[model samples]
Target: MNFYKNNEMVPMTRRYPDLKDKVKKRDNKISIQLIRAWDVERDAEKVLKIFLQNIDKLSSYRYWELLRSVWIICGTVENAQFFSSLMKSNKPNRHYFSTPEEHEFLRSLPDQMDVYRACNSPQDGGISWTLDYDYACKYAKDFQKNMVLNNKINKSEVFAYINRNNESEILIL
Candidate 1:
C-alpha cells in the first residue's frame, strides 16, 4: 500500500509503519492522518504576510477560501480590512461577496463597504446598478461616507477609553 505525507506519495512500511494495520483495515481508501503540531505558536501576522504574498498565484475560489480561514484564525480587524480590500479590487465581479451569507458578513464588517463601488458614475464607474445613476451615486457615496465616519468615531472612542485607563493607572502609581 502507498502512503502520502503533505500530498507526496511514499512507501507505507518505510514512512508510517504504525499506520500499516489501519491502512489495511481501511482498504486503501484511508485519508488524512493527524500529525504532531509543529508550530503551536505560529504568528498570525507572518501567516497573513505569506498569504498576501502568494495571493495572486491562487485561483479566486482558493483565495477567498484562504482569506476566510485567515479571518477565522486571526479574527483581527487588519485581516478583515485585507479581505475588504481584496473584495474591492474584484468589485466588478464580486460574485462571492454577493451571496446572501457573504453579503451579511460584509454588512457586519465596519467600514468595509465604504471602499466598495456599486454604482455607475464617472467617479464610481464600474458596474451599473438597477437604480438610476444619480440616485445610485448619491446612495453609495452617502452610505460609504457615513460608514467611514462611524468607524473613525468608534476608533476614537476606544482610544480615549484606553488613554483614560492609562491616566488612572499612572495616578494610582
Candidate 2:
C-alpha cells in the first residue's frame, strides 16, 4: 500500500481517471474482503492479504488508490469509519489529504451548502454531488437524458468534501 507523495495536491480523478468515470468492476469476493478489512479496526493483515492476492491485477499503489475512490464513491458511514481507521494505521498509504491546505479547505466549508448533481433520471440521487452549478452542467452534457439536480444540505449531512478534484464535490451518505 504505497502512497506516492505529490509536490502539489492533484485530484484523485486526475491521478486515476477511471475512479470516477469508468471504474472497473471488482470480483465480489475481493470487494467483500476489502470492506471486511477496512471495516475492522487496524486490520493490517486483511489489507495486506488482499494486496498480495491481487498483485497481478494492480500494483500496490493503484490498489490503495482504488480503495480511496471506493471510499468516496460508496459514501457510507461504515466506509467512512473504515477510511478514518486506515488513516490512523501505520500503513504506507495512511496519507489521506494531499496537503494541509486540502484538509483545512474541507474543514472550512459553511454550515450549509447548495449542492448539485447530473444524472440520467430526476429520481437519481447518488453520493457524489458538486458545489458548482456550471460543473454540474458540464456533467449533464455527457448524456442526452442527463438532468441537473440540486439541493440545500446541512454540513452535517455531507459525508465528505473533496476539493482535491477542484470540483467542490460533496458526498452525502
Candidate 3:
C-alpha cells in the first residue's frame, strides 16, 4: 500500500512508522488490525486487496465498506484510475453505496450540470468532484488551498455519484 507525502506516493510504512516491520515481514493481517486503530489512515489499498481476494468471505456490509473506502482514503486520481480499470471487467455494485438515500441523490442529478473540485493547484485527470460548489469551497478551506475548478459535464460521463455526507461527490471517467 502507498501513502502520499508531499504529493508523492510513498510506502505506507513510511507514513505509519509502527507498521514498518509488519509490512516488511509481509504480515498484512496483523498490520491491517494495527492500521485500523489509526482510523482514517486505515491502510486503504490493503483493505481493497483483501476485499478483492475474499469477496465471498466478507459480510455484505463489510464488502460495501471496503469498496467505498477505495475512494475515501486513497488519492482521488488513484481511486479514479482503479475504478476505471475495474469498469472493463465489472461495474461497481449498487449495493456498494449501501443506502437508498445515496441512490436517490444520484437519480436527482440533471443530465448535464456543473462539477467542481478543490485542490492546491489545478490538475488534470481527476475524476472525483462535487456537484455543490460550496462543498468544493469548504474542502478547499479545510486544506487552506486556493484552487477550485469547475467544469460542465454530461451525466453519461459519470462513473458514480457519492453523496454520503451531502458532499455531492461525483466520479467521472
Which of the numbered candidates is closest to the native, going by highest TM-score? 3
lDDT of 3 by residue, 1-173 (tens): 11113234312211122335534344445335434733655565665565567555444333444455544655465356766564333433444533455555667878899999887666656677888898788778876868899999998787677655556678776
Pairs clashing within candidate 3? none
Q: Which stretches of candidate 3 lie over 4 Å from their true place?
A: 1-41, 55-65, 91-95
lDDT for each residue of candidate 1 in 1-173, tens digit (9 for 90 to 100):
11111233312221122334543444222111101111344566655665666665554544554454454345333244445455455622233322334344334444312222223333322221211233334545654523211111221111001011111100000
Give the residue spans of candidate 1 off by over 4 A: 1-41, 91-173
Question: What is the overall TM-score of model 2 with all chains considered together?
Answer: 0.48
In model 2, the runs with Cα more than 4 Å from the true position are 1-66, 70-99
TM-score of decoy 1: 0.31
**Candidate number with greatest lDDT:** 3
What digit string (tens of lDDT, one per residue) describes model 2 on residues 1-173? Answer: 11222223554432332332223445334656766776754465566567557745643345555455444444443344555554343444323423345546656888888998877765544566788898788767754545788899898786456664466677665
Better candidate number, 1 or 2, judged by TM-score: 2
- Compute each candidate's TM-score over C-alphas: 0.31, 0.48, 0.61
RMSD of 1: 20.2
